[model samples]
Structures are given as C-alpha cells and as structure tokens.
Target: MRVFLGITGASGAPYAARLLAALVDAGCEVGVSASAAGYEVLATELYGDASLPHDEVRDRLVGGLDGVTVYAGNDYSAPYASGSAKVDGYVVCPCSMATLGTLASGAMDNLVHRAASVALKEGRKLVLMPRETPLSAIHLEGMLRLRQAGAVILFLAPGFYHEPKTIDDLVDFVVARALDQLGLDQTLVRRWGQ
Candidate 1:
C-alpha cells in the first residue's frame, strides 16, 4: 500500500513513530511530512531536544526505517498533492486541531492538508488520529465535518482491555488500531476474543 503520514503539532510522538515503523514493516511505501512545530515536538518528546535541525529531526525519526519518504510540510509539488499519485491512504497521526480545521474548511494550504484533500476527493481512505483530550464543541464539529466527508476520525484513545504494561504498549494499542484502518494486519495487540 502507498500511504502518506502527516505529523502535526500535537502530543503523541510515540504513536507517530510506531505507526511509521509498522507501515515500513508491513511493506508499504510511506511518504511523510511534518510541520515546524511538529518537528520541535518530536525532537523534545522523542529525542530529548527541541533545537534539532529539520534534516536531523527527520533523520532520527525515520533513520533506520525503510519505505519512507519525508517531504516539506509546505511542499505543494509532492506527489501526494494530487489525486493522480494513487496513494491508497493518508493518515495524520497526532492530528492537531488547527490541521483538522484546515482540512475541514477545504483549504489545502500545505502539503499535509492538500494530501488529505486529495484523499477525500479521490474517495481514498483517510484516517485522522487526533490525540486531543476534552474536545471542545468546535473540535467536535470539525471532526463531524471530516467524518461526513468520508474521513475516518480515529481518536488516539487506546483501549485498556489489552492490559497494557508500559507506555509503549499503550502506544502500540493505538497504532495497531490505525494499522487496522489501513487494512494492515498486526500482532501488536491481542484481539478481543483471540
């Protein structure tokens, strides 16, 4: 599968990292784009620094991962900017409310938003993993608008029925769900009746 992953300025870097690793392991061609604030958040949360350069941050995030390409957030010329690229799915892990509103408003001002718009217009699978908590009415309305537009509004809420043991386990639970939405089978977490 060809997938486009967008990282926005939201909490849950672990979810984004795990999802990318899972996508590569699943043999999917993945394209990635991260906003400026997204880079800083990843650096601080995952790498213990907030001043990492863009290239370095990208390197560290997808360093040893294969089948992944990183694009500038504002690069409107990327293949994902158009529906003709045949991208099977697009996911915005840790999707920020700002990004959500942009997409809901039908304003493709950046590569991430453009890719999502393409996915929606092409009737492709678009999964949005928003990690925000206590969503406001505006947030809920935006999510509803996206859902009505045929996007999967998957919240980053991990289920505890799997009995997670650590933070990584919790992250895996959410990433596993996202993978399932992409039609990727994973043994990261046990099934309900397995």
Candidate 2:
C-alpha cells in the first residue's frame, strides 16, 4: 500500500519517526513531508543540533530508511498532489493544530494540507494523528469537521492497556493503532487477548 506520512511541529517526533520506520519495514511505499515547525521540533527533540543543514536534518530524522520518499512542504507538484497519483492512504503522524485547521477549512497552503485534501476529495483514507493536549473547543471543532469530511482523526492518545514501560513502547502503541486503521496487521503493541 502507498502511504503519505506528514510530520508536524508537535512534541511527538518519535511517533512520526517510528511510524515511518514501521511503514518501511512493512514494505509499503511511503511519501513523507515535514512541516517547518516540524523541522525545529525534530531538531530539538530528536537531534541535538538546532541548526543542522536541510539534507543533514533529513538524514538524521529519517536515519537511512528505505522505501520512503521525502517531499518539501512547499512542493505542490509532488506526486501526492494529484488524485491520479493513486496513494492508498495518508497519515499525519504528528498533525499540528494549524495543519488540522487548514485541512478542515479546505486551505491548500502547503503540500501536507494539499495531500490531505486530495485524500479526502478522492475518498481515500486520511488519518490524522493530532498531538495536542487540553484541546480547546476550536481544536475539537476542527477535528469534528475533518471527521465529517471523511478523514479519520486519530488523536495521539496512546492506550495504556498494554502497560507501556518505555517511550518507544508508547510510540509503538500509537503507530500500531495507525497501522490498524490502514488495514495492515502489526504486533507493535500487545493486544488485549494476546
């Protein structure tokens, strides 16, 4: 399956990174985009360098993962911009509120929003993993609107039923749930019965 993974400025950079790695390991064709703030957050949270070069930044963020294509946020001509591109699904692993609002309002100011809009218009699976806390009414409304528009709003609320013991486990829980939404089987998290 083809997947579009969008990373935003949210604090959960590890989730996006893990999700991309999992998708690649699962043998899916993945297209990735990191928002401007996403780069800053990633630099601060993942990499120690706060002023890394763009290519070096991407390399550090992606860590030599295969089967994934990275796109610029401003590049509207990317394959994901066209409905005929035939992407099976799209996931904003750490979707920011700004991006969510843009998607809800039908604003294609960037490639991330545009790809999501394309997914919605084409009736493809568009999963949003919003990583906000103490959500305001506006955020809830934006999520509601996206849901009504047929986009799956997957909040970054990881379940503790599996008793996660580490940060990686927590990240896996959410990524596993995302993979489930995409209809791909995974054991990233322990199931209730298992």
Candidate 3:
C-alpha cells in the first residue's frame, strides 16, 4: 500500500510513532509530514526532549524505519498533495481539532490537510485518528461533517476489553483500528471475538 501519514499537533505521539512503524512493517510505502507542534510533541513524548531540533527529531523518528519518505509542510509539489498521485490512503494520526475543522471546512494549510482533502475529493480512504478529550460541540460537529463526507473518524480511544498489560498495548488497540480503516491488515491487537 502507498499511504500518507500526517502527524499533527496532538497529545498522542506514541500512537503516531507506533502507527508509522507498523505501516512500514506492513510493507507499505509511507509518506510522512509533521507540523511544527507535531515535531515538539514527538520530541517530548518519544525522545524526552522538547528542545530537540526538527532535523534531529525527524532523524530519530525515522532512523531505522524503511519505506518512508518525509515531506515538508509547504511542499505542495509532493505527490501526496494531489489527487492524481494515486495514493492508496491517507491518515492523520493524533489528529487535532484544529486540523479537523480545517478539513471539515474544505481548507488546506499544509500537506496534511491537502492530502486529506485529496483523499476525500477523490473518494479514497481517509482515516482521521483524533486524540482529544472533553470535546466541544464544535469538535463533534466537525467530526460529524467529516464522517458525512465519507472520511472515517477513528478516535484514539483504546479499548480495555483486551486487558492491556502496558501502555503499548493501549496504543496498539487504537493503531490496529486505524490500520483497519486504511484496509491494512494488522495484528497489533486482538479482535473482539478472537
């Protein structure tokens, strides 16, 4: 699969990292783009240093990961930014409410939003894994709008039904669901009946 993975400014960096790794492991060619604040969260959550520079943070994030390409936020010429690029799917892991609203409003500020817009306009698979809590009416409305537009609003809410033994387990549950939305097979978490 050829997929675009957008890391937005949200609180679930672990989920984003895990999902990126899982996508590569699934033999998918992944294109990644991180907003400024997305770099901050990844540095703080994964590297324990919020002061890390963008290059360092990105290096550490994709150091050993294969089949991945990183794109700049303003790189509109990238393939993922266009509907004619033949992208298999697009996912915004740890999607922020701000991004949700932008997408819902049919506005594009960066590659992430543009990729998502391409997916929606082209009728391709688009999974938005928002990791928010205490959502306001605006957030709910934005999500509903996206769902109505044929995008899957996969909230980053991990289920405890599997009796998670660690934080990784919790993250995997949500990642598994997101992968499922993109039509990628994952064994990160057990199914409800299995």
Candidate 4:
C-alpha cells in the first residue's frame, strides 16, 4: 500500500507516532507531512521538549525508517497532493478540528489538506483520526459532513474490552483499526471474537 500520513495539531501524538511505525512495518510506502503545530505536539508529547528543532523531531519520528518520505507542510508538489498519484490511502492522525473544518469545507491550505481532498475526489480511502473532547456543534457537523463525503472519522479513543494494561496497548488498539481501514493487516491487537 502507498499511504500518506498527515500529522496535525492535536493531543494524540502517541497515536500518530505509533501509527506511522505500524504503517512502515506493514510494508506500505509512506509519505509524511506534519503541520507546524504537529511538530510541536510531537516534540512536547513524545520528547518532553516542545522547543526541539524540527529536524531533530523529524529525525526522532522517522529516523531509520525505510519506505518513508517526509514532505514539508507547504510542499504542494508532493505526489499525494494530486489524485493522479497512485496513493492507496490517506490518514490525518491527530487531526485537529481546524483541519476537519478545512477539509469539510473543501478548503486546502497545505499539502495535508490537498492530499485528503484528492483522496475524497478520487474515491480513495481517507481516514481522519482526531483526538478531542467535548466537541461543539461545529465539530460534530464538520465530522458529519466528512463522513457523508466517505471519509472515516476514526477518533483516537480506544476500547478497553480487550483488557488493555498499558498505554501502548491502548494506542495499539486505535492504530490497529486504522491499519485495518487502510486494508493492511495488523497483529498489534487481537481481533474481537477470536
């Protein structure tokens, strides 16, 4: 699978990081782009240093990972920006409500939004994993609009029915579903009714 993973400004940096690793482990060709705030989130949540340089953060996030390419937030010329590119799927992990509104309103300000727009227009799989609480009416409506547009709004909430005992387990629960949505096999979590 060829996948585009967009990291946005949200609270679930762990989810985004783990999902990126899982994508590469699944043998998918991955393209990554992080918004300015996304980089901060990664640095703060994952590294405990919000002031870490972008290059260092990038190195930490995708260092030594093969089959992955990192693009700038403003890199509109990326292959994922166009539907003509053979992208199998697109994911906006830790998708901020701002990004949700932009995508729902058919607005594209960066490569992330453009890639998602192309996914929607081309009828390809697009998964948006947002992490937020107490959503207002605007957020709900935007999510509804995107759902109706055929995008999967997979929240970063994990179920405990599988008896999760650690934070990584909880994170894997969500990432496992995301991998499934992208039509990739994942053994991170045991399947229900197994």
Candidate 5:
C-alpha cells in the first residue's frame, strides 16, 4: 500500500510516531510530512527536547525507516499531491484544528491539505486522527463536513478494553485502528474476539 502520513500540530506525537513505524513495518510505501509545530511536538514528546532543530526533529522521527519518503510541508509537487499518483490512503495523525479547517475549506495551502484533498476527490481512504479535547462547535462542524465528504475522522482516543499496561500500548491501540481503516492488517494490538 502507498500511504501518505501527515503529522500536524496536535498533542499526540506518540500516536503519530507509532503509526509511522507500524506502516513501514507493514511493508507499505509511506510518505511523511510534519508541520513546524508538529516537529516541535515530536522533539519534545519523543526526544525530551523542544530546542532541537526542525530538521533534526524530523530526522529523529524518520531516520531509520525504510520504504518511507519524507516530504516538506510546502512540497506541493509531491506525488501524493495528485490523484493520479496512485496513493491508496492518506492519514493526518495528530491532526490539528487549523489543518482540519484548511482541508474542510477545500484550500490547498500545503502538501498535507493538497494530498488530503486529492484523496477525497479520488475516493481514496482519508483518515484524520485528531487529538483535541473539548471541541468547539466549529471544530465539530469541520469534522462533520469532512465526514460527509467521505473522510474518516478517527480521533486519537484509544480503547482501554485491551487492558493496556503501558503508554505504548495505548498509542498502539489507536495506530492499529488507523491501520485497520486503511485496510492494512497489523498485529500491534489484540483483536476484540481473538
């Protein structure tokens, strides 16, 4: 599978990082992009350093991954920016309201928004993992619009029925669910009936 992963300026950096690794582990061709704030969050959450350079933060996030391509947020010429690029799915992990609103408005301000727009227009799978709490009406409405447009609004809330024993387990639960939505089989978390 060819998937585009966008990390936005949200709180769930762990989820985004885990999802990227899982996607590569599943043998999928992954394309990743992170916004400025997304890089900062990754640096702080994953490396315990918010002062790291943006390139260094991105390098840490994608350094040892194979079959993964990293794109700049403003790279509109990326293959994922076009429906003809044969992208099977697009996911915005830790999707922020700012990014969501841009997508909802049908504006292609960056590669993330452009890729998502292409996914939606092409009838491909587009999953958004938003991590906000206490969503305002505007946020809900944007999500509703995206849902109505055939995008999957998978919030970053993980189910605890699996008796998660660690923070990584909790993150895996959500990543597993996102992979499921992409029609990718993964054993990151135990199945409900298994």
Candidate 6:
C-alpha cells in the first residue's frame, strides 16, 4: 500500500514520527510532508533547535524508517497531488488547526492539503490526527465539517486502559489506533482485549 503522511504544527510530533515508522515497518511505501509550522513544532518541542535545516528535520522526524520518501510540504507537483496516483490512504498526523481549517474548507494551498483533498476526492482513506486540546467551538466546527466530508478525524487523545508508563507509550497509543484504521499490523500500543 502507498500512504501519504503529513505532519503539521500540532504538539504530537512523536505520534507522526511513530506512525511513519510503523507504516514503513509494515512494508508500505510512504510519502511524507512536514508543514512550515510542523518544522517549528519539531524544533521547539522535539529537537530544541529553532533553525534546523530541512534535511536535518526530515532525518530527525523519520529516524527509524527505511524506504520512505520525504517531500516538501509546498511541492504540489508531487505524485500524490493527482487522484490517479493510486495511493491507498493519507494521514495528517499531528494535524494543526490551520491545516484542519484548510482541509475542512477544501483549500489546497499546499501539497499536504492537496494530497488530503485528493484522497477525499478519490474515495480513499483520509485520517487526521488532530492534537489540540481545550478545543473551541470553531475547532469543533472545523472538525465536524471535515468529518461530514468523509475525513476520519482521529484526535490525539490517548487511552490509559493500556496502562501507559511514559510519554512514548501514550503517543504510541494514538499512532497504533491510526495504524489500525489503515489496516496495518502494529505493536506500538496494546489493544483493549490484550
């Protein structure tokens, strides 16, 4: 399967990273894109460097995955831009409010949003892992709009039923749920009956 993974400026960078790793490990071809704010979030929250280069950012974001291709968020000419690209699914892990708003409104200003829009138009799976908390009415409305438009709005709300002992475990829970939605095998987090 070919999956397009988009990372935005939300707080759950780890979730995006782990999801990419899991997708590659599952033998799926992956295409990745990180938004401008996504780079800011990675530098501020994950790497502690405000001026990290794009290649360094990509290296840090996708440290463990192999055979995965990374694309610029602004590259609208990428293969995933067209519905004929034959991608099985698209995921916006750590989706931000701005990105969500764009997707909800059918705005394709960038490759990430365009790929997501293409997925929706093509009737393929499109999952969004929004990580914001204390959501306002506007955020909820945006999410509703996207959901009604056939997008799976997977908020990065982790469950404690698995007895997570660290931040990584919590992030994995969300990523695992995303993988489950994609019909991929994952051990990133435990299932309910396990």
Compose the digit string of candidate 3's lDDT tens values, residues 80-181: 988878889899988988899999999989999999999999999999989788999999999999999989999889889999999999999999998888
Greater TM-score among 4 and 6 belongs to: 4
lDDT of 4: 0.95
Candidate 6: clashing pairs of residues = none
- Best TM-score among the predictions, by candidate number: 4
Backbone atom clashes (below 3 Å) for every candidate: 0, 0, 0, 0, 0, 0
Model 3, stretches more than 4 Å misplaced?
A: none
lDDT of 5: 0.91
Candidate 5 stretches greater than 4 Å from native = none
Candidate 5 structure quality by residue, lDDT tens digits, 25-75: 999999998888888888888899988998888788888999998999888
lDDT digits (tens) for residues 1-194 of candidate 4: 89999999999999999999999999989999999999999999999999999999999999989999999999988999888889999999999998999999999998899999999999999999987899999999999999999999999999999899999999999999999999899899999999
Against the true structure, candidate 6 reaches a TM-score of 0.95
lDDT of 6 by residue, 27-46 (tens): 99999988888888877777
Candidate 6, run of 10 with poorest lDDT: 185-194
Question: For model 3, where is the 10-residue window of minimal lDDT?
Answer: 181-190
lDDT of 4 at 41: 95
TM-score against native, each model: 0.98, 0.96, 0.98, 0.99, 0.97, 0.95
lDDT string for model 2 (1-194, tens) is 89999888788888888888889989899999888888887787778766766677798867778888889999888999889898999998789998998898888777888899999999999999998888999999999999999999888888888888998888899999899999988988878898
